[model samples]
Target: MWDYSDTVKEHFFNPKNARAMDDADAIGDVGSIQCGDALRLTLKVNAESEVIEDAAFQTFGCGSAIASSSVLTEMIKGKTLDEALKVTNQDIASELDGLPPEKMHCSVMGREALQAAVANYRGEVWKDDHEEGALICKCFAVDAVMIEDTVRANNLRTVEDVTNYTKAGGGCSACHEGIEEILTRVLAETGEAFNARASRQKLHASKEKPPVPGKGMSNLERIKRIERVIEMVRPQLQRDRGDVTLVDVDGDTVFINLVGACSGCQMASLTISGIQQQMMEDLGEFVRVVPVPANHAATTGVTA
Candidate 1:
């Protein structure tokens, strides 16, 4: 039972474009059952005009997810691809008068589905800029480009803010630190939005927490947590015909090496980002994981 806004409840109960469009020019579908939400979007485009004549969606998700998709379709109708591309998760949430922090990810799914459809319309390639960056959130397949874009687009200031706008850290929470780093870096780019050094200081200044047993995670406990996160995300890589092996853990940095098919795959940056994010969520916010760098894991799409 959540206190959903009137718009959210209205769209959830009577979603627009709820039916399928068999003649859609492009269809973008993303998310998974494991993540608890998925969207299938279809659009009928007027190619000569380069405009979306009609759009429809069939979503399998919570109330927010459905509502997000519903509102998304309405927003994009009669707009050119350029105009549609500008629509983001923030726009969807704003339309619904905002969502609870934890449920923000649902809106993100709507945006992804629309992006995928737009990409499909343009071509089979996933032209979304984020796919080229590190994939930070595996549960929802969130990438660094996506998170950075959301932060910049909405001026997200904190990890929780990132989650609110893009749901980057809402799922497993392993990517909380990774998202925080991105938030800091994005803010630093503006030269006034944030202080990266101060942010890092905050993450490392946890020494005040007593080292007493049961008071906080011990070194051994932390190592075990890291291992569990690896195991949890390992299957996701395997599905891509790739493999990852732990190489070393240096302070906050966990270095891993990619192998097999993924060793040379162009999508490795995304893979590395996914691994780092999951570890941060499982191990807590101070983690800074990196791949062994294929050279140095190809510099990871998300830079320091």
Candidate 2:
């Protein structure tokens, strides 16, 4: 289970502003059914163009969602419209005491809902400055420049390859549109062709492992063993400026991705085949270790 923050747990168990305002000047609704988190906010503006009257919200989400909405309402209740608009998503996240990395977007949604409500009141169009130019990543709020920089720095080629450098479409699948756009921009900007053979060669080299005969293990057991090994060896690997993750397990061979400060470090290749490989070997002879490429696939948002 997720460790809920004290403030987040309190708001979740006993949410405030859980109803619509009777004479609300504006109402905003944002979210998609696919994401399983939605919010509805109502605001009543006073004569001085401030939110002096009242505010309320209804949220269908996990603790983060409920806390984000509840806290947002409380924060904006007595503030002027301008002050309320200044309450950023980061502000909301911080007010909740904190939210998990994945849940940061929920706080972001709360901010979006508030902005939408204000815009609805003013009859203004909604625009995301984060996507003013280039292209927009519908999935993770990333822009073309962000995707291109990540790809070029990491030497990524395919759509999946982009995931490692930048988590563009790793969130809501709705962002696939933005991914395709960024991919096109990258291809056009580079004017360089993708070499299928080279890509395959890189992938294959990353998956190297000696063949092991007939020693079988259930997938769950292998996964559990891999997880244990990952936790045990992570600190040691980090000491050498590297981190490891279980990518895939085929038969007895376990594929791992070494990343972060270690990605392009001088000893990366050696550490993967030497230290990590040796550690897994102690587990079982059939456990062949492979160093999957840094650019393998996008990390889907953490499972809630």
Candidate 3:
């Protein structure tokens, strides 16, 4: 069973702006019965200010999909088109207090519907995704560019992460191979190899006395190694207006403190686990992580 957060349940049961707008300036209706999820998004814009005067949605799918649509409409209201364009799937998930990873595509669908709706309003082509590259996932109409962008943006490593984030290989299992190819290229572009032991190999192969990648190292060296990996991870979190501060390290147990938009989120523990997983993958299985209590960080006045 999956844990549906309070925010997701709240919006699912009592959705906001879940209605058809006959007078909408622009409308985007997308998805299919095959996918078990579809969204129709409508918007009314202020002619002069270009602000979104109102937004509404009609979604057909799971509770998360409906909640995602409801929350997306609520979040973009009163914002300018450009501001709304900046709202990503991560923002929708965060607004819902975070979704189960497998349901993340529901949030992605909401963002896509909004973009399609906005494109209609501006008299632009509804899907410019093709301009980025050829189509890869026929089931969801996912293209190469979209897949690559999602992989790089989230630092996704596994085939499952790609499916969860982009819905590319979620349909037929055939695209899994293609998605893996793209993921490999993206990871290569980061100048790092995939596999949980790749970084360890790098450490062992180096002669410059660089910090080793796991346990049984000096505290200072271990901290240096972990901090280096965090440097790679933090920017993605910060891009979503969330942050994690290193509180302390105890053997395999690493402590982190969430900050910024993530500070009050109900899914902070999930976020911490994600951080831990990434860190362990990079450094080794010897590492585990937990979020430090807010009270502790508060008293210590630590910033993420």
Candidate 4:
């Protein structure tokens, strides 16, 4: 189980200002129910002082999402829109003591909602959608611009880290190479070392290997070993209201489908990494875990 802070639990079980405000002066909406997370923030502003007199939110998501939204409403109350705008995602996580690295995206969502609400009040155009050319992750509607901004804001170091923060590269696995390119450029500009290939090699090296390496197993033997490793990891995910199913295996890449809560989870990247590490150790060979769409069979073929 995740080690949630006491304050996070408190706010989740007893969220404040969770009701809709019919007379709100400003409103912001983000995410979609189809995506397994959505939030609508409403604010009552004092016209003369430009202060947020009240705030409320309605969200459809996990406990962390509820806590983030609840704390955001309280934090922005009595502050001017400009003052509220300065509140970052880090601040929200701090206010709740702290959120797990996997749950940090909840805080980011809260910050975006506040920005959208302010834009609404100002009568300015605010959109989260991107053009097809700029889109990066079609599964989550995450664009390259969003990925770049998040990498800078969070100092993200890996494709997994980006998935935890922005849900990019968390599904299909086809956008991973694209995400790595963005990360490489961003990290270079910031004077950070981000050798994508080296980083991946390092991750593989960090995993424990078999005591004695065998010559190599046949394809049938390899598939069975992968299945056994996945079976070992499946119970842990199921305990958390999620599950995984093997879709197909092609050479070093093992395709799988995340079902239940795991389907759109922000922690998916970590989950995939864990599965990959285990498979490599058990099979005594390099392997990559790639999450495919649940309906992968309907598609032409899994890529990446």
Against the reference, the lDDT scores of all candidates come to: 0.75, 0.71, 0.78, 0.84
What is the C-alpha lDDT profile of model 2 across 1-304, one tens digit per residue? 7677999999988999898677789888888667688998999888666654688998888889999999999999999888899898878977898777557778888998999888878889766443223435543445667787777677677655664345555455466556556656666677976544654575586467553433576657657767887887688666534588877665555667888656764445545555455445645554556677756532332223
TM-score attained by model 2: 0.48
Model 4 misplaced regions, further than 4 Å: 129-304
- TM-scores of the candidates are 0.46, 0.48, 0.54, 0.47
Between candidates 1 and 4, the one scoring higher on lDDT is 4
Model 1 / residue 206 / CA error / Å: 18
For candidate 1, the per-residue lDDT at 190 reads 81
- The C-alpha stretches of model 2 lying farther than 4 A from their native spots are 128-304
lDDT of model 3 at position 242 = 81
Judging by TM-score against the true structure, name the best candidate. Answer: 3
The backbone clash count of each candidate, in order, is 8, 1, 0, 0
Candidate 1 off by > 4 Å: 127-304
Candidate 3 lDDT, 1-304, residue by residue in tens: 6699999999999999989898999898878787688899999999888899999999889999999999999999999999999999888998898887567778888888988988998898876352335667765557788889888889888666776566576666588778778877889997866563543364354323344456576778778777877677678678658887787776677777788866765445546656665676667554667676644543344343
lDDT, candidate 4, residue 225?
A: 88
In candidate 3, stretches whose alpha carbon ends up further than 4 angstroms from where it belongs are 128-304
> Candidate 2 or 4, higher TM-score?
2
- TM-score-best of 1 and 4: 4
| Model 4 C-alpha lDDT per residue in residues 161-183, reported as the tens digit of each score | 78767777777878998999999
1 or 3, which is superior by lDDT? Answer: 3
